[model samples]
Target chain A: MNPTTLKLCLMAVLSLVGIGLYGLMICRNLIKMVIVLQILVKAAALGLILAGQMSSQINLGQSLGITVIVADTIVAVVGMALAVQVQRRLGTLDVDALSSLRG
Target chain B: MLEAILFALPILTALLAGIQAIRTRSLIRSALWLAGVSASIAVLFYMLGAHQVAVIELSVGAGLVTVLFVFAIGIAGAEIQPQRPIVPKTLAWVLILVAILLLAGFALPFATTVQHSTEPETTSVFWQQRGLDVIVQVVLIFCGVLGLLGVLAEEKAPLDQPMVDEIAAERERDLRNLEYQSSQSMVSSQQGQTR
Candidate 1:
């Protein structure tokens, strides 16, 4: 595919992911929102990879993107586990209601 | 154009996944849709001739991340009422306008170039000469997963017990309240029997 075409498609993916990210922010639940946020990050990573490919040396972009995926997976899993723990202990996942530091 | 056409199936599937994900009420369904999206996009990467990236997105993006989302949804349960998405409504118009403009102004020219006799030579830059950086990415993914396994092992000990206590307490209160009312009526009925 031509570079311009790739860029356009990549932009579409970015816009979609951005929409999801906005949704993630608006939701009250932590776990589902985090998962949604990850989707946004993944979309960004894909765009970066495709843009990199368009310029040449596709492997470099591919490898860096993979690195990101791996790290992101770890972060996501840890975050999910912590969220689960909090939900189990607190009996709720709504962040607004769970604020103990509020005076 | 031909290459893009070749990927039409997976592209549509991926788009469907995104649409489903954005609209689904259940967290589990949304997570599943993300999985579908990842898989379709992975296929798209393959069509774009990025075999290695496709492999990574398939295993890590499609496989590992989806697993994480599913597990998250599992722990959270399917008891939510998602709100309507206003951002999407605004985005829809913006995206449509941008697409129309890009196609009319830029994409049409690119599309015509699809039939150009000679394809431009792609970058022989850093990718073709990857050196040792590939090892770094593999190690990063492995290390992340390994660390997660350890954390999960430790976290499992207290997994969700605290929240269960709250739910249990609420249930106990409700049950006691019901029992108290039942006894009052029972006593009244017994007095009637005696009379």
Candidate 2:
């Protein structure tokens, strides 16, 4: 990545991280929470790629990025499934309603 | 100038997608915006010379993740309900402004100094150094899929009794109508025979 692109990537990472934090703090819905988390993970992946580029280890960064992508997909799938189950059993999608841990 | 713009396209795309994903009311629309973000990031990956990673990002991030999200939304039966933002509008905008200022302050100094790497082929690195991680990731994906199915497999009663009851009543009415029609047809045949 060029200097401009690197800066852009860093900018993206910062923006996404901020958005993810804000969303996670405020969103009441579980699915939305999962989406926000994905955003955060994406930022981390971008950061890893940027780090790799800076250090002249592009392959290492690419490998790490791949790992991040795989892990994120798994997280998203599991999280969405959990959200579906929560909506099924709890009758609400709101996080407040899911406060019960008895089950 | 064109080179800079070309490189900036994916970043700009990602920014727009993030904004849309955050602001969209419908969960499905949000998921779509997420797809947009993923696709843009894949483009960025490709531009960065990680071709294989870019393909995986496109396939997994843009394709599989979106499908899963859409499926989950379908299962949830969520409406196009507008979510109330956690922060007030003015507050959110103000926060965004602050974030932009901070990002600029942080990134400006490094912008001119970062050098592009002469990257080795990405595939060899994955197989050589990161092989174990790949295997583990594959295992994680398996576990995740199984876990999802396990969660979904557990049967639960319908959350809304009224909707279930309404469906039952509609079915019963249909059955009753069918019976009534059959009985009327039988009686009409007997009358015709007598005539």
The TM-score of candidate 2 is 0.76
Q: Please tell me the interface RMSD, in Å, for model 2.
A: 2.9
**What docking class should model 2 receive?**
acceptable
RMSD of each: 13.4, 11.2
Q: What is the DockQ of each candidate?
A: 0.19, 0.40
Which residue window of length 10 is worst by lDDT in model 2 chain B?
B150-159
Clashing residue pairs, backbone N/CA/C < 3 A, model 2: none
Tens digits of per-residue lDDT, candidate 1, B1-195, equal: 776566556766776777677666777887788788778777766766667767878887778777777766676566665554434666655664665466346423433233223323233433455445556656766766665564355444543677789889999999999999999999999999999
For each candidate, what is the lDDT?
Answer: 0.64, 0.80
- List of clashing residue pairs for candidate 1: A56-B123, A88-B163, A89-B162, A89-B163
Candidate 1 wrong stretches, greater than 4 Å:
A101-103, B82-195
If you score just chain A, what TM-score does every candidate get? 0.83, 0.91
lDDT of 2 by residue, B1-195 (tens): 666688788888887898788777788999999999899988887877667778998998999888889888888865545656667867866786787688678766765565556765777788877789979988998989786784466566554688789999999999999999999999999999999
